[model samples]
Target chain A: MKVLVWAEHEQGALKDATLSAVTAAAGLGAVDVLVAGDSAGSVGAQAAQIAGVEKVLVAGDAAYAHGLPENVAPLVVALMAGYDAFVAPATTTGKNIAPRVAALLDVAQISEILSVEGPKTFTRPIYAGNAIATVESSDAKLVITVRGTAFAKAAREGGSAAVETVAGTGEAGLSSFVGAEIAQSERPELTSAKVIVSGGRALKDSETFAATILPLADKLKAAVGASRAAVDAGYVSNDHQVGQTGKIVAPEVYIAVGISGAIQHLAGMKDSKTIIAINKDEDAPIFQIADIGLVADLYSAVPDLVARV
Target chain B: MKILVPVKRVLDYNVKPRVKADGSGVDLANVKMSINPFDEIAVEEAVRLKEKGIASEVVVVSIGGAKSSETLRSALAMGADRAIHVLSESEVEPLAVAKILKGVAGEEAPDLVILGKQAIDDDSNQVGQMLAALIGRPQGTFASKVEVEGDAVLVTREVDGGLETVKLALPAVVTTDLRLNEPRYASLPNIMKAKSKPLSTKAPADYGVDTAARLTVLKVVEPAVRQAGVKVPDVEALVEKLKELGVA
Candidate 1:
């Protein structure tokens, strides 16, 4: 099978998530990488160096500079003729673009695939990760998005494939980009961070969330995360949410503060190497997976832990 | 302008699904069901648009079994003008749902379509985009804020680490995220009134679409379990343990 993998990048450097996607596509068959952006040439050179990539395809166009799905979807559709499968990392850009490509091709798309049983078979979590379903697709052209945490990143060196240029379909002109407000944080991204400290609704409000959770997170240099309840309660922004509906993180250490451990929140972090729970309720479901359960009030425990650390 | 909102009934977000003994699928015999949380937000957004006079009508639609009428009624109670239930017993994937919705959109000629970014049951997050692509309209997914002008709608979407604003032409699709709005509870009087409102049901075949399973589920299994290790009496002990592991 000839599989085309979208090489997701930012600032001309490949994202760590795409390495996992490359690993997923390489499992199926021969792999080709497509770099679509204004600086595709620089990115293409980097993509061509990833091990097991057969060839690199570059579409250097300003319309794709921000990777607006409206522009990227048509480019994928135009290049879908010779490939049997198309894959992307299940990131914001990939999630936005792959579905449109699948729809234009009139095929069903598989999202957040956890395992590749075969070229047509995959394992993915449904019902908020309560049940894992293995499914076999019958579509002629398989469009898939691989969950980054489920697979190991492919090696970044030891291969040099030829890079080829591809033309972008002119802009659809249906939607125009107005502006973006990106959070500038010195800490690592939540998805790739080695340690994460998450807060829950028990924190009460935004002030407490920052006052309690931020100190411990800063002491450990860990990424800050929040349960959906906290995000819904306006304790933090949506980007900080860690749950089935939010970003999934499998860090080395996951600390839950004031969280009751809803199943949806656990689904995103249960795979962490070590888990710790600090909540007022002893029966909070978070204790079920915590390696260290501290039964106490977070208001007191969190500040103490922050000082001790 | 008429606005359409697609809603789906799923196992309530609070309920943790359990796999059956035979590994067939989740046991839903006695599980509590409600409108998907995101879909509720979608319905709420539509109702707000109607209230603001930006939309002349708000129609809610669902595709499912007989129980789906209950879901549609709830939408009507929340302020939808009427309801359309596309009755189907088989498992309707995203593609089939989009096709059926396309048929309904052609008949309704809605200027705007609002839907949940994803259904919690399958979590596919594909229908809205698929419908937009099939109808040759633009989409603004994961919308946190929306503003309508004469010919276009400006949507502020929640992206990875930030927010992005886009202006899509009218006759577009917008998928709601959690921050869009807080859904209103259906008052007793409104629930009573919803039952008398018009509700039209049709089979999937009426839309000239096959709501068949394009994929077969080979197995259903529980995720790997994590065991609770030990408890710490004080914060000092926790710090000591973390230091021992070199994590702190």
Candidate 2:
């Protein structure tokens, strides 16, 4: 069985998550990494170097820069027959394109799969991570999206790959991108960050959050995140939200401050290796999963924790 | 403009899901079923659009067994103008569901179509894009906010890197993400009002749509259960335990 791993990139560089996905695609069978985009050439070269990858397919076009279904769906569908299984990082790009390809090919998709079972089955979290479900696809071809961070990223460099360009007129849609406004930050994205410091409604306001949470994040060299309650309360932007309805993130160390740890919030961060909670409420659900729990106000505990680190 | 919201029925998030002994699928013998959480958000958004005078009517649709109409009621109670039930005797794969929805689009000609990002049951997350493809319409998926402006709809999507704002022409499809909006509960008054709302039923034959499963579900199993970590006495004990395990 041949597997195709879809690599997503921005500007001129491949996203590290895609590399993690390639590492995961290793479990299926002989991998043929497929990189789609105008600047996909750079990403394709990286895929060929991955140890398990037999070859790499590069579909490059200037029009493919920003991932839109109009372009990616047809290209993936056209390439679907060449492989037995397809794997992609469960990023927005993967989530958007993989299913379209699966639909076109008339197959079911296993998304955000945490583990593969033998050859044709997978284990994925469902019901907002409250429970995990196992799916077995008896189809000839299997398509899956993996949680990129769960796998070890393979680093095999110094090689090249054959290029294959897919001709597609982008989808006729109601919307077009005028521009993008990225957060002006140096820290890694919250989803990809190994150590994350997240604040909840307990932060009180954005000013307190900046003064308390920011310094602590800086001290830990961790990414900053917020709870859904914080975003809803206007204490943080929606970008910082971490919850079932927001973003599902699993980090090495998840330090939640003033977060009561609602079931939805826990659904997002419960998979972290180490959980530390700082809250005045001893009964807060965050403490149930915390490796370190300080029953003190975040206003008092945060600055001191930063100093200690 | 007429709006179409595609809702999915799944195991309620609050309840624990049990796999069937035979592994056919989730054990739904007596489990509580509800509309997929994200679909509720989609339904809420469509109903809100109508209430805000953005859409002329909100149409709720579902592609599943006869029981799926219960989930459709969720949209009706939330303020959808009417409902369309596409009952399939067997499980319909995502691709086929999209094809069915595409046929509905041809008949209904809705200006906008909305659905949950992924169904908790299958977790395939493909129906919206597939439907968009079959209908030959642009897609703005995982959208947090959608507003109509002129002949286009401005969509704010949750991309992996950051928020992306895309403006698509009218007659596009958008899928709701978790952050889209908080789904409103149906008050007792609204629940009563929903009974009077129209729910039209149709078979796949009526729309000339196929709901066959190209990929068969051989079985479903419980995830490999893991041992929850034992709690240490305190922070100092935790550090000691970490050191005992390996490096402190």
Candidate 3:
């Protein structure tokens, strides 16, 4: 079986999500990476270096710069003739376009596949990870989005593959990008960080969340994350949210301060290597998955720990 | 302008689902069910649009079994003018659901359609976009803020990088994110009034759509459990443990 993997990129570099998607697509058979955007040439060159990729297809147009689903969806649909399967990471870009491609092809999409049992069978979590359902698709061609955290990033450098240019569909004129307000952070991206410090509603307010969590994050050189409660409470930006609806992370160390560990939040961070929980409430659900639990007031405990670090 | 909001009834967010002993599916024999949380936000946005005079009427719809009428009533109590319940006995995939909704849209000809980004039960997150494609309309999904302009809706979406703003023509589809608005709880008086509201029921066959499962479930399994680790007495011990693990 031949698989086409959508190589998502940002700032002209192949995003980590693409690497994980390559890891998933490699499971089926030979993988060909498709990079569609203004900077597809550079991104395709980078994608060609991934170990398992056989070739990189570069489709470029000024219209594809913003990764708008309306613009990107058509490009994917146009290129789906030969491949038996199409795969992309379950990121915002992938989730937005994969369904449209599936709809255009008259096939149902299998989303966020956690495990691939065969060419057509997969496992994915449902109900906020409270249950796992294994499903099999009988469609002639499969369209899927793989959860990045479920797969290891494919090797960055190996045998070089040939990069070929593909035709661009140009703008569909259905939608236009109206600028974005991405948070500029000096720390590592939350999803790919080695250590993550997450705060919850217990941080009370934004000022307190920054005052308490930032010190520890700074000391440990960890990316700062927040539970949905913290994001909904306006204690932090939604970009910092780590949960079922937010960015999923499997960092080396995950420290949950004041997070109650609702299943939604746990679904994002439960796969971390070492988990630690600190909250005033001993019965917080976070303790159940925590490799080390500390029952203490975060206000006092975080400060003391920050000073020591 | 009539606004259509599709709500789904799923197991309550607080309830932790249990896999059946036979590994078929989650046990829903006697579980509490409520409108999906994100769908509640969509309903709230539609009602607010009506209150703001941008929408003349709010019509809440659900495509599910008879029990889904209860969810529609809850939406009615939340200030929807009417409800449409498309009854289906078996499972319906997102593509089929989108087709059913397209049929309903053809009949109602609403100016706007609002829906949750994804149903928590399946987390497919495909219906709204697919419906937009089927109906040949633009869509602004995962919307955190929606502004009704003349003949268009300016939506601020909560994207991965940060927030992205987009403009879609009227007769568009908008999916609600969590931060869209805090859904108002239905009051006693409104609940009483909702009992008298018009609720029309139809089957998928009436819409010329088949509510059949496209994907077969091989089996359902309980996720691997994470054993709780040892608890330390205080912050110092926790620090020591982290140091021991070489994470600090």
Best by TM-score: 3
lDDT of 3 at A148: 93
What is the TM-score of each candidate's chain B when compared with the real chain B?
0.97, 0.93, 0.96
Model 1 chain B lDDT-worst window of ten:
B239-248
Q: How do these models rank on DockQ, best leading?
A: 1, 3, 2
Tens-digit per-residue lDDT, B9-94, candidate 2: 87787776777777666777677889988899999999889888889999999988989988888789999989999988687778
Return the clash pairs for model 1, or none: none
Model 1: lDDT of residue B206: 92
TM-score of 1: 0.97
Q: What are the runs in model 2 whose C-alpha is more than 4 Å off?
A: A156-175, B18-31, B183-190, B208-248
Query: Would you list the C-alpha lDDT of every candidate in the order shown?
Result: 0.91, 0.78, 0.91
Clashing pairs in 3: none
Between candidates 1 and 3, which one is better according to TM-score? 3
DockQ of each: 0.78, 0.44, 0.77
lDDT of 2 by residue, A157-245 (tens): 64454555556555444446756665768877787787898998888888988888999788667889999888888776777888765
Tens-digit lDDT track of model 3 for B186-224: 999999999999999998999999766779998988889
Candidate scoring better on DockQ of 2 and 3: 3
